[model samples]
Target: LSEIYPRNLMRKTAKMGGLPSPSEFVKLVNSSASQGDIQIDHVEVIAPIYEKWPPDSHTRIFLDSSNKTDEPVYAREVLSNFLSRAWRHHATDAEIDQKLALFAKIRPKCDDFQEAMVEVLATVLSSPKFLYLVPPGRAKRSGKSGDGNRLAAWELATRLSVFLWCSTPDDELLELSARGRLNDRDVLVSQVKRMLADPRSRRFSRHFVRQWLGMQLLDFLQVDRKAFRQFNPSLKEAMQEEPIAFFDEVLKHNHSVLDFIHADYTMTNERLARHYGLKDVYGNDFRRVELDSTHRRGGLLTQAGLLAMNSDGK
Candidate 1:
């Protein structure tokens, strides 16, 4: 009866209470269950079962498990769905038919319908029509005749959102463009403010700071061991994170940009804190610490990262 105790009961107990010794707990539970004082209706099994299939066999068994046969019309529907999602617009009847014809040509060579669909998806993803941002209809001049073409409202909105927010246009921006109101100053400004307020705007600050400080190459930069024996891989990683974390706090909390030049508070982890001669710091996590003028660590130039990078080889 002790051997009959369900494995899942032991697992659940361990998960909920935190297992210190799993084997001992399991043995104890099994012994108690086998004493016949407690009734055991069922034993829970937790181990996963493995199945072996042929190397060439399609793992997606559901693809042809249905008695329903593949229809040409269904292929067209699949193509339409792909185009709609890829282009973010409704597909024309001619476009759908053309894709269906391509699918029909490729379907016979593939053993399964899913394999045929994969081929179509690959083609669609690779096509210039899906990859490039193209304006609908013919190119027309804006104000100058030689300028070629002006960006459509949707294109302009998408470009602006990607530039400022580093993401796709949100529903509000998309709707404004769809309604031909995206270019309106008040509407555009409102959308801009909303976008900037979103969490995605942190990407802009991260990108800007990384590029401005040349910290983007920190990963590839080689550290001199003779000059700074303390600068190991972990120390280098902490150094990279310290500046970014400090900048993020300043931007998120609306601190002045000048604070970066001479902020009283800066980020430091245990390794970095010790490296810079900071006291009362422990653990691997980084935290902002206020520095007094007497400490003489007022700016980023005084930080260990910059000092290590600029030091002469010993």
Candidate 2:
């Protein structure tokens, strides 16, 4: 059993047909009567959930601080740290003070400091500073600029991160923006290059490719096993990943966009390679393989997932 974060897909696989599962789940003493994958007759045994004592999740939230017990003392420290991160490192003293006051007011009504602090933390999370990217109005350019919707250094960093990484700016980007020189053309280019080079940019590839190609239809389309006997659930996943992986490769190498329509290679694993009548490629991991005219596979149109999704299964 793989300890993967995405819901342990191996556990729910149907053993009868080597195809995608479409069965509905029901909880009973003998729900899966004849199934080999799930034994409903036998007591369902789960793998050991926790590998470490006190667990990482608990230690992460309930941090190892000196004032773990003293809510009055630790509330300021915790709130400040949490607000800074939640606000994408743009947390201000005023915001911190407001949260601390809320915590103090709620402390007496709640059973303990943790419970009271939680209420304050919720408010901080819900605040406009945390939710909205209210750009800092820094239109004071040296040359000549009036009302140039120019995002402040920190604000630009936030948008850049969210645009590329789908998350908050890292410490490096935030520090660069705070220096106020991030607006400089050369500096901005360097920062953009840095962000595009980071592993987090994979989020952009995934998000962009999915939206660009209308991949959501794949989720609802049922594969016809009678026609596509080789098609399995894992192959279905690989299909969705192909376009994203291809896009990521192009972005990483700064390849021409024309490659999208006519590439020299395609992303594939053993599952996909086999489906495409490719030889020698093996393993579940996806990688680009050189393509030739004889292969009859070139670009996104030839991708198994797209072909399958568009087909009537005849």
Candidate 2 backbone collisions, by pair: none
Error of 1 at 132 (Å): 5.5
Candidate 1 lDDT by residue in tens digits, 38-122: 6767646453323554222333322332433656755666666567545544456877787778778877877666567766777
Q: Model 2: per-residue lDDT, tens digit, 138-252? A: 3233443532322366678888889999987777776777677677899888888988899889899899988989888787778778986767666787788888888888888
List clashing residue pairs in candidate 1. 2-30
Cα lDDT, all candidates: 0.64, 0.72
Worst 10 residues of 1 by lDDT: 27-36
Q: Give me the overall lDDT of model 1.
A: 0.64
* Highest lDDT model number: 2
lDDT of 2: 0.72
Q: How many residue pairs clash (N, CA or C atoms closer than 3 angstroms) in each of the candidate models, in the order given?
A: 1, 0
